[model samples]
Target: MNLIAKLLPAIALTAGLSAAQAEGDALHGKQLYAVRCAICHSLDYNGVGPTHKNLIGRRAGSVQGYAYSPALKNSDVVWGEANLKQWLSEPEKFIPGQKMFIAIPDARDRADIVAYLLQAGAQQPSKTP
Candidate 1:
């Protein structure tokens, strides 16, 4: 095979990642979070679920105070982008017996939400009042 053929697959992979990243629009993510996640979660406080702030790099279910399921609390899951996306896609499948019951079937929505979490998580966290 020629050099161009060897490079084609790598180029395509790069483009695919770029496209996925680009799909996560900030405004759309914020809107979707309000509509979809705010019922049980918040950026600052622990509601039905734990706060989403500082979630990207933190271990899953390691947040203090909130009662996590035994399955999640015992497991070791660091919330990188890919795992976070997977958890958003299917909570039970990602971590069996976890309390969260929602699933974002659309990949775009997951991407947007993941983007929003990462962006927001990087900023100063809100006070948990």
Candidate 2:
């Protein structure tokens, strides 16, 4: 076999994996959210937790009508991908004394959830309180 032939399979596999990782599976993410986060959160309005409608770009603890922990309310954190990943990995560790206790141990799962939130937020119209 030529060198090009030997390299083709490896290159193809690498490309496929990279593409898969680059964009998360939003459908799977929605399912994960339903199972893991729906009880505490909602897309359109505040539930036990704050509304997740426009969570990605919104500042921490800025959701209207929902009471937030002082630690989170005071923290100057913006909800971007990196911050979301860190927060999901360990909420307490990210923001000490915050009310959230759930932690998604798997990095891939966290990524998926964040992707779902991003996609969902984009699909829905913004709600003004």
Clashing residue pair totals per candidate (backbone < 3 A): 0, 0
Candidate 2 wrong stretches, greater than 4 Å: 1-14, 123-129
Q: Write the per-residue lDDT of candidate 2 for residues 1-129, one digit (tens) a residue.
A: 699999999999999988977777677889999999999999889998898887877899998899999999999998887888899999999999899989999988888888888878653554699
Q: What C-alpha lDDT, on a 0 to 100 scale, does residue 45 get in candidate 1?
A: 95
Summarize candidate 1's per-residue lDDT along 1-129 as a digit string, tens digits: 799999999999999978866768767888999999999999889999999878877887888999999999987998887898899899999899998988999998888988888887664655799
Lowest lDDT sum, 10 consecutive residues, model 2, at: 118-127
Clashing pairs in 1: none
Whole-model alpha-carbon lDDT for candidate 1: 0.86
Which prediction has the highest TM-score against the true structure? 2
C-alpha RMSD of candidate 2? 3.1
Q: TM-scores for all candidates?
A: 0.77, 0.83
